[model samples]
Every structure is written in C-alpha cells, then in structure tokens.
Target: MTSSLMRKGSRPLRLPLLIAALAFSGAAAHAEDEPGSLPRSFPVATPAVAALPAAPTLGADIAGLLEQARASNPGFAAQRAETAAARERTDSAGALPDPNFQVELMDFTNQMRGGGTTLVPGRVGETRYRVIQALPGWGKRDLQTRSAAAKAEQAAAGLDAAWLDLALTIKQAWLRYYAADREAALARESLALLGGLEEATLARYRQGLVPQQAVLRAQREITTQRIAQVGIGQRRRGAAAALNGILARSPDAPLAAPAEPAALPSALDLPALIARARAANPAITADERGIDAARLERERTFADRYPDYSVGVTNNRARGENQTWDVMFEVMIPLQQSARRAREREATQMLAAADARREATASRLAGELGSAWSTFTSAQETRRLIRGTLLPQAQATRDASRAAFETGRVDFDAVLEAERQLVDTRTSLLQAEIEARTALFEIEKLVGETP
Candidate 1:
C-alpha cells in the first residue's frame, strides 16, 4: 500500500512538470512570432532626413562666459578674499611681541606730610618706570614667517583650483546648451518632412493607391517628433538656467544661444599631460605648499624646546636730586617637557600627513588625466566614424527609399524607417562631439593651459 501511494504522488508531480514545459514552449514560440522581435540584420533603406538650417550666429562665447563667472561667482569671490587674508597674515607672522610698560610708586605716603598719600610722581618718595621686550627662541621667528608664507601660497593655489572648477562647469553647460539646441532644430526639420509625407500619403489614399493606415502613421510620427521637440526645448532651458546661476544672475534670465564648441586636437599627449598636471594642477600645488608649511611648523615646534628671553630697562626718580638707571633680564623656563614632547610629536605627524597627502593628490590627478585622455580619444574616433561613414550611408539609404516610395515600388513604412535611422545617426554624432569636447575640458581643468 505504501508503494502504491508513492507511485500515485510521482504521477501527479510529472503531470505538473509536463504542463509547465508545454507552457514555456508555447510562450517561446509566441515570442518568436511577435512583430517587435529583434532582426539579425538592420533594415538599410528608409526615408530622407531633412537637412537643418544653419543656426543663428548670435551667441555667447565660452571665453566670455568664463570671464563673467570668475568675476561674478560668489563662491569664487570668497576664495579670493581668503587668499588675500592669508597674504596679510604673512606680513605679521614674524613680528616681535608687544613690549610691556610698568610704573611703580615706591612710597605713595610721605612721612614729612604726616602719612598723607601723594598723587604727583614728582612729589612721591620714589618712582620707577620700566619697559620690557620679549624675544622668541633663536630661529623660531624665521620658521614661523616661512610657515605663514607657505600657507599663503597654498591659499593662492586653492583659489586657482576654484577658478578651474568654475571654468569647467561653464564649459559643460555651454556644451549641453549647444547639443539641446541642435536636437531641437533637428526635430523641427523632421516634423516638416513628416508633414510633407502626410500630404503625399493623403493624396495616395484619395486615389486608392495607399491605405488610410499610411496617412495615420505619418501623423503619429509627427506627434512623436513634436513631443521630443518639447523635451529638447526643456533641456535647453535647463542648461541656460544653470549657466545663469553660475554667473550669479537670476535663474530665469534669458541667454543668447551658445556658440559652437572649439574643435579638439587630432592627437593628445597623455604622458605630457600627466607631467603638466603634476607640475601645475592647483590642487596638487596646494598640497605641496601644505607640506612645506608643515615642515616649517615642525621645525618651529622643535625650537620651542629652547628658552625665550626678555630684556628690560628701568629709570628711578626720587624726591631729592638723585637719579638712577637699572637694567633687567629674564628667561622663560621650558619646564613642561611632557607637553612639549607631545606637541613635537604632533607636529612631526602633521608633517608626515601633509607629505602623504601631496603624494596621494599627485597619484589621483594622474589617474584622472589618464581616464579623461582615454575618453577623449574614444569619443574622437566615434565621432569620426559616424560623420565619415554612418551619416553618409544613412542619407543615401533615406534618399533611395523616399524615391522608391514616390514610384510606388516601396511601402510607406520603408520611408519612415529610413528617416528614423538618419535621425538616430545624427544624434549619435552629436553625442560623440559633446563627449569629446567635455573630455577635453576635463583635461584642461586637470593640467592647466600653457601660459
């Protein structure tokens, strides 16, 4: 009876598994018959992509925009102010400490006047005036001065780095604006082409040469293009707003269309770029200055182990006709050995940390330069291929299909498909152009331009 029950359970499990397998097979068969199934080869013939008119030449140039940002951006202005303050600090870093003055009344009450207090110094029993100047340990002042100067240099480098960041942002915004504007222009041109196709399809339908579906398809494509145009326009406005904000203007402020981006060089010298960045990149320079400052500070802390000195001169005046002069000297005792040692260790560790940071900064900058160079080269090649090969081929196919459709040799779908391919090819070219230019801007920000 147990064996009979186990066999019955196994039969039930097999029936479920068999049903699942059949269901999967039917789903796969249906997927293969689906109209949107991927084809092994792309369709080559399609309608013509209308050529866009030239953009108006009135626009803001990138150089002008960068200058405007540098002058107007509040963050950059704060950095400039900090740099100036650092410079001011350098002038007073090594100045001597303020002198001390004291006046002593040896006897404020006069015995001759029955113990009455005297207010005037000339009538007092004795009066003393002293002036004292304190001097730091040997070489401490020089070290402090050098350290402060190094810090000032670091601040200046930081200012330069901030400017570079602002410039890169402006360039990126300019490129985005250009790309969106071009896309919008392309969409408008495509819409006109679709309208012409719709009219032709309507005429063919009236003569019963084509079905109403063909005209409907044209109208749908026009609607789609119009939707895309609206999106592109929004992107364009957003880019403009970003630029305006960076320039310290109202976000809704209107901006002239962006000019065409500068062309990238045919070849880049990656090793040379890395070398330049190591020497000139402001962040790396700032780190190097920090190491110098830390070294000076460590030396100054070591000097703290020695004693400081104070010298004073005293003049004594009496009620009688006698005057005397006195000279005094004082020394600071460095009795806090534990505290001094701890401070020395702290300074030494800070020096090491600054050195490590400089090394890390250099390595990171090199890595970034290499990455940007790779992207720039890749985008350049892609742009070349699209413009030289893909664009012309797409245009030829579109023209051929459009001609065939007019002769009634090809269906309207072929023309529509070719137009899409042409538009896609154009978009790809624009993306490659923007990518290459953006990479070039990154490189410039990293390595700095030649003087």
Candidate 2:
C-alpha cells in the first residue's frame, strides 16, 4: 500500500515536467514555422539634452523684466517714497522753532488805580505786544542737522536694500518659472517617447512575441508620464503666478518664455565679492549711517546740558502815557540733572548698540556669502558631472535595455527602470542648473548689485 501511494505522488510530479517540455517544443515549432515574424529590435528613442531655454542675447530679457518690476511694484514704490520723505525731513530738522507772539494786558482790572476790570487790551492800564524767539544751545543746530542728514542717508540705504531684496526675489522667481517651464517641456517630450514605446509594445503583444504584461507596463508608463505632466503643469502655473505677483501683474497674465541667465561677472571672485559687500551692501551701509546718527544724537544729548535762551522785543502802551519799547531776554535753566543724565546714558547706549549692529550685520553677511559661494560651486560641479557623464550614461543604458528587451535578452522591467533612471538624471541636471543660478543671484544680492 505504501509503494502504491509513493508511485501515485511521483507520477503527479513527472506529469508537470512532461507538459512543460511539450509546451517548449510547441513554441519552438511555432517560431520555426513563422520566419521573421518577431521584431528583432525596437527603435531606440533619443531624448533631447536637458538644457535651459536658449537666448540670442544673455541678460536682456531678464534685465527688462527686472526694470518693469522696479517700475511697477507697489512695495518698491512705497519704499522710494519713504526715502523721499526722509530727505524732506532733513531740511526742516535744523530750522528754527516757530516764534511765540504774546499780547499781555497788565493789571487788566486796574485794582491799583481802583478801576473796573476790562476785557479790551486798549482800555487796560497797560498793553504789551511781545515777539519772542527761542534759541537752541551752542552747536545744537549743527549737530541736529548732521543727525538728520545721517538719518536721511540711512533711509537712502534702506531704499537700496529694498531694491536688492526685490531684485533677488524677482530673479529667483524667474528662475523657478524657467525651470518649471523647461521641466514641463521635458515631460511632454518624454510622454511622446513613451507613446511610441506603447504602440510598439502593443504590436509585439498582438504578434505574440512579447507577453501581455509588457504592453500593460508600457501603457502604464505612458499614463504615469501624463500624470507627471499634469503635476509639472501645475508647478509651472504656480511659478508663473509668483513671478507675475512680483511684477504687479494679474496671476493669470500671459508671460514670455524665460531665456538662459547670463554668466557670472568675470570679476566676481569670492574675495572681490566680499569687498563689494563691504562697500556697497545696503544693510551694512544703513548700519553705518545709524552709527553716525547715534553718535551725533549722543553729542546733541550732551549739548543739552548747556542752557538755551530766548530773546523778546515788547511794544508797551499805557493809558495817557507815551508808547515805549522794551527788550527782554530769558535763559533756560537745566535743573533736571537726573533726567538729563539718564538721557545721556541712553544716548551712549544707543550709540554702542548702533556700532554693535553694524558689526553684526557685517558678520552675518559674510557668513551668508560664504554659504552661497559654497552652494554655487557645488551646484556647478554637479551640473557639469550630470551633463557630461551621468546623462549620457543613462541614455546609453536605456537604449541598450530597450534593445535587449526586443531581443528577449532582458525583462521589460529592466527597460522601464532604465527609462526612469534617464528621466531622473535629466531632472537632477535641471535642478542643479537652477540651484547654481539661484546661488549666483544670492551672491549678487549680498553685494547689492543694482538692476
């Protein structure tokens, strides 16, 4: 009984091998009967190089856009207005205070003469018309003028800073828009390639040269590319909206395609850039102006210790008496010593704070420049490597895999993976390009490059 059971199990195992052998033989016979029925290789699709948009002339388009933004952006306009207002304030800061005019009816009741009170100045015992001018302490006006001038300088520097910031933002936004636009174009190109592959795969499926799964995979890839294209389109629109917002345009406004960015200036060594920042960076300049203003304010505070005076001329008229002129002078006494001392201390602290702020701004800008320089160099190297080495390699691998798939030497998954790798490498190159340009723009902003 045990031998009988073992024989039954062995027969079941041998039956599968026999059937498999026959099926292989039948497939071989079928292939032999239909000569040249299967495709030996599929057409290799060559993708375009992942490059930025071409320009006939570098920097012209972007420069014009920046100028438009500067001219139309409301925020920048407000900043310019603020600077103008500050300049106007400097003119009035040192001007003399308005003079005081006084009309006095001395002894209006005339009690000493036993007369009734009178509201009329002419009927009073004595009427005086006085004009008085208060004078600030020595050197106070000059110090105030200098302080106001410094403040005006600070405002001008602030305007410069605003412009730098806006320019940087505009540059970055433009770059983002360019990258998205290019990526969308690439996606469309990829989709077209995939569509061809899908058609070829369906033909192979119909001929029974390849499995149905291959056709499904090709179709899936085409669909996925379409999905990615949708995403890229969304990103492109978002970037366009941001750029349009910067230019004070409607979100849905049409825009020209972006051109390639200009190369960095030949003189833009790191050390030279740092020097430029020191000399031209608006934040540092503003801080320096703040220090000057604070120093002048401190001096003016100390000058407050000196007394201010007022001079007056009076025209006196008395009833039944000749008109007379009187000259008067008054001096201000600085009696609040504690308050004045506190103010002096406050001014001193403010001056020190301003000095500290300048140092801090310089240090911070140096660190930012260093970071941007590092990023710029790294992105440039990455882009070069991808463009020169990785992109070509990926494309070659994809073509080889596709050929192998057609000849039945490799699986369909390998071909799909190769395509994905090629796409990813191209994307990485695009990102690297964007990063390098963005870092360059950051450096320009740090150095306060004007439009």
Which residues of candidate 1, in runs, are more than 4 Å off? Answer: 1-59, 107-113, 116-125, 318-323
Q: C-alpha displacement of 317 in model 2, angstroms? A: 1.1
lDDT of each: 0.88, 0.86
Reference-based lDDT, residue 167, model 2? 91
Q: Model 1 reaches what TM-score against the true structure? A: 0.82
- The TM-scores, one per candidate, come to 0.82, 0.84
Superposed on all Cα atoms, the candidates' RMSDs to the truth, in angstroms, are 24.4, 19.1
Could you give candidate 2's per-residue lDDT for residues 1-451 as a string of tens digits? 5564356536434657869999998787777554655433445455697997654332235787788887899999999999999999898988899999999998899886678999798788999999999999899999999999999999999999999999998888888888888898789878877787778677778888889988888888888888888888898889888978887888887777777667644224788888899998999999999999999999999999999999999999987689899999999999999999999999999999999999999989999999999889888889889989999999999999988977878877888898889889999998988888899999989988887
Which residue pairs in candidate 2 collide?
none
User: Which residue pairs collide, candidate 1?
Assistant: 46-418, 47-415
For this target, which candidate reaches the highest lDDT against the unseen true structure?
Answer: 1
